[model samples]
Target: MFKFLGYLFLMGYILIPASMAQNHVFVEAESFDNKGGWVIDQQSFAVMQSSYLMAHGMGEPVSDASTTVQFPKAGTYQMWVRTKDWAPYPKGPGQFQMSIDGKPLPTVYGASGNDEWKWYKGERITVKQLQVKLAIQDLTGFNGRCDAILFTESTDFTPPNTLDELTAFRKKQLKLSDQPMEAGHFDLVVVGGGIAGTTAAISGSRLGLKVALIQNRPVLGGNNSSEVRVHLMGDIDKNHYPKLGRIVRELDNGDPGNGNPNAKEYGDARKIAIVKAEKNISLFLNTHVYRLEKQQDIITAVIGRDIATNQEIRFTGSFFSDCTGDGTLGYLAGADFRMGRESQAETGESLASTKADDFTLGTSNLWASTPRDSVSTFPRLPWALQFSDEYHIDEPQSDWQWETGFGNYNTITQAEQIRDHNLRAIYGNWSYLKNNKAEKYAKHKLAWVAYIGGKRESRRILGDHILNQMDVQEGKFYKDGTVTATWTIDLHFPDKKNSQYFEGQEFFAGTKHIRVAPYTIPYRCLYSRNIQNLFMAGRNISTTHVAFGSTRVMRTCGMMGEVVGMAAYVAKKHNTTPRGVYQDYLSDLLVLVKDEPTPQP
Candidate 1:
């Protein structure tokens, strides 16, 4: 029996022999030894069951990703590849090929006209050697993706197609234990590595709580990370609890400008350094928390799966924080939550919709282009979103405005589709500029494009008090008000001009700003109402859609995290719950919120 070696970071491999009892070999595309220019895409992992490798070279073919595979014996094998035609309307532009050793496969994958992911059969090949190299060669730089490859001597064996079956199959194949390995107990567990989650973990750690900070992505900051490139917004350190944003200030180097082409401006390393400096905090990167272990209504542990290896780890904690932006953790724990807009009558907020509908703020997949020394050429894609001179965006760079999914799509389940729609818009617009308006953009080339969608709104975990627009606009201060929100009620809508062309699937966005005086959000808005021990920060906080417009910004959300952390400290000290901190220990919490020592890096 040949045991699988743990993942090798330098080689990006988890070597295992194919001679095992299963007889079939499964290779995850994301586990390629040399990824070359391919990227790991985990955005649709929950829906798709696995993180795949994508070639996001912006219409240019990326370098091939290669790995070594060991076969049990030299024999003919049937191969199947899990993939899909991303744009299968006419023909997929994201076409790619596979190579065994050095010879390319006859079947061109990703253009099979299959919209849903399925196993596409490839030509059976004779394995001449026990060890051979496998490679993925991209033909189009558009977003060709591969989930996993299967090789089996039994021709009748087929991989599972359904989500539940596929998940179980993968677990069995990977030898993942049904019982997750322990990730240690913590006083507080903060899920998500965004600004709010980072601050929450740091604040809790500094306040004498052992903390675990879990982030799904490789880097922190979420939208502010180089991957999404959104600048920090909202004012900090000017609230009733002035010391609440101390950790935020220490982490905010400066604005990198939304969708900046230069990655250095985002300060990914700086954020990592700050989180690592906290001794009481344990940081888990590329770990996505999906399952919750609960007793009654309170979450006792969270199960996180490593995005790369599919290894599951259980984190037990006395207190839990839902900073996943999408309220993923809260949802798993059966926390009461809200989504989309609320009716004006429901919240008594003037900015809310007259009648409730699912018209929430859209998600953005920002892109940027830079001028090159030499002229650049782009292929006209018939399958991409068709854009005419009157319909296309003329800008060289996309900011927060290059958004989609305002009222049409579910921001969570349809996230992958939303991102693809944005990609089609971007590529189509760029194609028009390069082919039709050649003189203007002759030297311009696509520099950067975010594959990870910068989401605005999702499930808002219900809390003790749901803040509304009137609370901010009327400057009504509650006695329990803690985090101060200072940004305008900037609600985004589908741009009318773009909507006229694309109808229900608008790719551009516009916003109306309802200016408001700086207002403090009540402490009751920070913790789950039904799920007793649950706390929330970031865009998932309890608020009407109108109030969320002001509180969703990074700086404002970070302050909410700081407040949650302080409240957690008081709760831990007194052996009380999050609401208990507000009810019985409000004074103790306020002292910490108002005079907590500034975080040092």
Candidate 2:
């Protein structure tokens, strides 16, 4: 029977073929009917710009992932899979093979190739039946990955190697849309669903503006989400926007510690329900904004792709918010932004270096372990980086300070390298503790390890006024002061002990806490100087490296969101841009801010 299998299911952005060719098939690993023990990993999308299916066996071989495919023609076809050799060296730990109709392939892939993505070819075979089973069998289960598979009768055809070229190829082959589908028209569109973004959407919607909240992940709260598990820091309901932060308080996670074992502490379910209940707001999750459309200096629309469905949605809004911690939306819109540290000569920051440098705070893939009644055994890792006694993490639990990638790599561009480095550090440490000193870790088993690493700093989108360390130190109060940042100027650097052992490869970090009284951040630092209609909240807001230490906390970012939400309404009412909210309609916005709560219509 000729049937349209998973491949035929069309998303809004994916173009339906004019006609089906029975001999050629392209299967996305993530779209497999049955994933078995294989898990879908999208974290490296920042680096690889694509998602894949991985056999995360944790040092053990996992079950096979299988799918039923119905072939229209019983003819000879060549097979090829897009994957990476994680270990890259010969006879690496991670290895897997492809099976067709119960017959395993002769060659084992993903073990002895380079780290770069390439097509691993397989044998040409004649289909004996109209329907056959395709399976990916894991050999080692140590994180062998598969992005996609191609079965074609064309003997001379080869897939593109680079990301850009491959994207063009896929667009041509799949017949994808030249333009994205219209998602919706909104008074305000917030590009991130963190506390800052969630509150921004709620505030705007309650004030009678149609809002759209786009989140790349499945849940709200960004870094504070259960996946990352960082508790909300800094203060709310204090200073200028006393009444402004009621919304943030409504959705705050009450988790006392960073790596809470109780799943309920993350508040993922509660946030989804609350956002779903709001009538004026439209929330789109699992949608990543990768591109933007701008007319002159004003942002006209943003283009986002749904990771699961591969459907692209073009959101049109009068005003847009870049709350994505990476400042993704702003960067796409060509907003002026700064990455890395500025020199003391440039910003006159006391803590800054004599010269500018490309060093930013590191990222932490926080993890936790629980003590079980029975002793649990973890696999010994020979492929991981070795840690000396001085640098070894002796405990089973690792928190926020277990950070990496500061001077080692770029947190934004080289994200995969950073993630892999962090993973190696974690696995290497755990393996050493479990293997060498078994008795110490006998009762503890790994409970949770965040694959979605919690990032600290990336791009800081420059606004009309860039808040600096001097501003926080002197407590400079601007006439347009909106959000009160209360956290100390807490900066992080590589721990001296760890640095001594690992040198430039240190994974652990130590904080340099400089206490400061709460200070007001002006409205001028909330919107882009060049991008007229762009508004910003969260860690991406206009602040120098030193000043960001205080404003980067979740609560302060949430309050910034609250202010942006109020200002969005004023922008819509007065028919102006984000700058206009600070210039012409400051009084109207301040009225909304000072009041306890604006009555929801």
Model 2 lDDT per residue over 1-601, tens place? 0022122334321332111243467666766667788877776676566677888766677899887665667888898888877765344566889998888998787876588778878888788796778899999867788888778888988878788887766555455576876766899999999988998888888888889899988889888888788999988856766776788888986755787766679899998888878888888887888888889999989988766556567889999999998999889889999988899999989888688888899988887878899988877666666765555888878878888877578888877667666777787888788777777888887776676778999999999899999999889999889888789998899999888877898789999889888799998888999999999999998989999888999988888888888888899888988888888889988888788446477
Best candidate according to lDDT = 1
Query: CA lDDT of 51 in candidate 1?
Result: 88
lDDT of 1: 0.87
TM values, all candidates = 0.96, 0.93
How many clashes (backbone N, Cα, C below 3 Å) per candidate? 0, 0
Which residue pairs show backbone clashes in model 2?
A: none
**What TM-score would you give candidate 2 relative to the actual structure?**
0.93
Q: Where does candidate 1 stray beyond 4 Å? A: 1-13, 16-21, 598-601
Top candidate when judged by TM-score against the true structure: 1
